[model samples]
Each structure stands twice: as C-alpha cells, then as structure tokens.
Target: MKHRRLEVFLEFLFFGLVMGITEDLIALKFATGEPLTWKIILIVFLVALPFAIIGELIVDRVRWWRKIRRTFQKHVSSVKSSRK
Candidate 1:
C-alpha cells in the first residue's frame, strides 16, 4: 500500500512538472520572449504543485471507483450465468 501510494505521488509529480514546464514555456514565449531561467522554472513548479496534487487525488479516486464497478459487474454476470 505504501509503495503504491509513493508510485502514485511520483506519477502525479511528473505529470505536474511536465504541465508546468509546458505552460511556463508558452507564457514566457508570449509575455517576455525570454529563455527559461531557474527562477521561472521554480515559480512554475511551485504554482503547479497544488494543482497536481488535487488532480492526482481525483484521478486515483476515479480509478478506484472504476475498478470497483468492474468487479461488481463481473461478479453479477457470473452469478446470472450460473443461475441460468
């Protein structure tokens, strides 16, 4: 369980990092026409952190819910077929 949680966290962090960098690059291109700086990168990462965490949580929950639904459906189908 702990390992799975860590994996999820890392996955989310990577997702956030990629999103932040992309957005920062686009914004910089339009706003300042400047190359990436360490400061800008840090700022983007910081700003994206919360959004990433929230998105990760939501995604995890949805995945869990889907798994449960699939399991329930499979069980019900099995039972129905057995009865028939």
Candidate 2:
C-alpha cells in the first residue's frame, strides 16, 4: 500500500513538473516583449505544483476505475467457466 502511494505521488510530481515547464514556456513566448528570467520560471514552477496534483488525482482515479473493471470481468468469466 505504501509503495503504491509512493508511486502515485511520484507520478503526480512528474506530471506537475512537465505541465509547469510547458506552461512557463508558453507564457514566456507570449509575454509582452519582456525578457525571460529565472524568477519567472520559478513562479511558473510553483504555480504548476497544484495543477500537477490535480492531474495526478484525475489519472489515479482513472487507473482505479480500470482496475475495478478488469477484476469484475475476471470474476464474471471465472463464474461462467465454473458453471459449465
């Protein structure tokens, strides 16, 4: 259980970092003729953290849903086989 939680956390963090960097880059490109700076990058990274968590939660829920579906299908197939 702990391992699973850790995996989820890592996945979340990775997603967040990617998204944050992407966002920062896009924002920098469209800025009002301002030069990019380390401070701006840092700010974007910080903002991306929460968004990343949210993305992770969404992915995790989808993962759980798929697992449940697979388990259910397996159980149903097993019952049908035993009945024959």
lDDT of 1 at 74: 100
Model 1: CA > 4 A from native: 63-84
| TM-score (C-alpha, index-matched) for candidate 1 | 0.54
Worst 10 residues of 2 by lDDT: 53-62
lDDT tens per residue, model 2, 1-84:
999988878977896789778877787778756777888778878888777777677755677889999999999999999999
Best by lDDT: 1
Q: For model 2, what is the error of residue 37's alpha carbon versus the real structure, in angstroms, after optimal superposition?
A: 0.9
User: Root-mean-square deviation of each candidate, in angstroms?
Assistant: 6.2, 6.6
Taking all chains together, the TM-score of candidate 2 against the true structure is 0.55
Model 2 residue 83 distance off true place after TM-score fit, in angstroms: 37
Model 1: lDDT of residue 22: 87
